[model samples]
Target: MKATTFPGMSLDIDIQELTPVQWPALEKLFGKNGACVGCWCMFWRLEEGERFQDVKGASAKQRMKALVAQGQARGLLAYVEGEPVGWLTFGPRRSFPRLDRAPSLKCDDADEVWSLPCFFIHKDFRNQGVATALLKFAMDTLRQRGVSTLEGYPVKVPAGATRVANSSAYTGTVPFFEKQGFKSVAERPQGKQRMRKSLVLRRSARKQGS
Candidate 1:
């Protein structure tokens, strides 16, 4: 993908797909905390019965690297000038096994959907539209790949609150996804929500609808 500079921003932001060669950029973006208390962005990728705490830090980082090397983990990174500043994780629904176990997110069309489960933007770049830019790029990329639907599990902040804490916003905020055309389809516990967006037009059964 080409480098893009969104309006109202002076610096150019480039979005690129994750690959082995781009691991260093991701590493630099994630920093020592692994993008939130040593998560290393492996929360949703964990298998059933796998504990996140066990692989929280360096182990989690290594596991992510392994997935990148083996071509299993998929995501996109956003860069400004030459520094990585943002990330978005997405792939086939089945690839994110944890989603299968989520009671609220369960659906019959799992096989036909792509899941976008996480995003991380550098602290310095937060609220500058980096996340929105990344999401738009991912949508375009997936649509071009013929994906018909995309899903995300974002956190819904409490009413009357103007902003959610950064930690709770990792999955993104409901308004953010709604601005991107996603609709809340189910309510999960703990203010989390299951939202979906259709990437393509569905076939009509009738020539003229009543």
Candidate 2:
């Protein structure tokens, strides 16, 4: 378990990558609704087809499980005092088939580029820095794994907007990505902006400063 602490918060936050054996923890975190719309974090991973619509809840869960079984980078779960509270979905850009059709979002030619497609934080943990902690953990983990770049598709929303639901913010807010050192590289026609971070450059800078 990787732990981080913040001032005034007594408990340490731990984030961990999911394995087939830890599926139960994710099941417990997502609960009965399957993390909204029976997605199971398979929204971008699968192509849009009748089969996709047909596999609503349980089937979607199985599909994600099968991906996890493939042994590639799937995502990480955040735990506070041993209870799972948040999730971040990330992996090779091509692993998500739907990206090919996404307007204004295209993968670069680099083989080591990864994409962060979504985030889900439990209701109780919202605005508590859990997502930020998870993001930091993910950056370090990916850098150590030799990822060249990281990309994200976050929504461009007005500041302090309460009209949006938590579920809709799954793609993440632009400010959140900015705080993580990601810069806007492009924007979609529909207002979803693409952000990129060069892990390779950051690593080089850190080493130089050291």
Candidate 3:
């Protein structure tokens, strides 16, 4: 697919895997609010008590930095003319502790699977295709890494609703995932839906091509 311009942004967008060196870019995109009340994208990594009690902000940022520094399987960042504009995180389902107990989002298979639970697009880049683009990039990255199955937990957007608020749509909408070749595998509580995709690719070829 051709690179497309992000709305209100001058240059075309590109996606790159997140790294420790890119912390500054993530911080800049998240801003002082920490991308939804200081979440820093660690809402699903923390324990239930911590996530619900509002124990975020600098602490959450530090935790995420630790993950990046440790070379843990994180997500990718979207850049437009070198400015970070979006973030999408995913990894082995086990890497995320909270998913173990998330109602209706629990593990359903024993095979190796990656879970994409969240995304954060810069306020200026919202309503654009940033999230979708990042998701596609993620699929290719995962496939090259030998991942065969990918799962996602998305929200069910109300029928006829033009737009959902950022806070409620962080997990993505069902329709969006479907368009990306994901199918509904299960339904979770609170309008949440579980989706999955089986990938077919020559993992060895990716390494050789590189």
- Identify the candidate with maximal lDDT: 1
Q: Rank the candidates by lDDT, best first.
A: 1, 3, 2
Per-residue C-alpha lDDT of model 1 across residues 98-206, encoded as one tens digit per residue: 8889887788989999999999999999988899989999998898799989999999888788888998999999989999999988865457799999998545622
- Candidate with the larger lDDT of 1 and 2: 1
Compared with the true structure, model 3 gives a TM-score of 0.85
- A best-first ranking of the candidates according to their TM-score comes to 1, 2, 3
TM-score of 2: 0.87
Over 4 Å off in model 1, which ranges?
Answer: 1-11, 188-190, 201-210
The parts of candidate 2 lying over 4 Å away from their true place are 1-11, 48-52, 158-163, 188-190, 202-204
What clash pairs does model 3 have?
none
Residue-level lDDT of model 3, residues 62-101, one tens digit each, is 8877878887848888988789999999888887778777
**Per-prediction tally of clashes:** 0, 0, 0
**Which pairs of residues clash in candidate 1, taking residues 3 or more apart in a chain or in different chains?**
none
Kindly report which residue stretches of model 3 are placed more than 4 angstroms away from their true locations once superposed: 1-11, 48-51, 188-190, 201-210
Q: 86-192 in candidate 2: lDDT tens per residue?
A: 99988888888677667678656636678888898898888888888778888988888889789888888755664456766898878789998899988654357
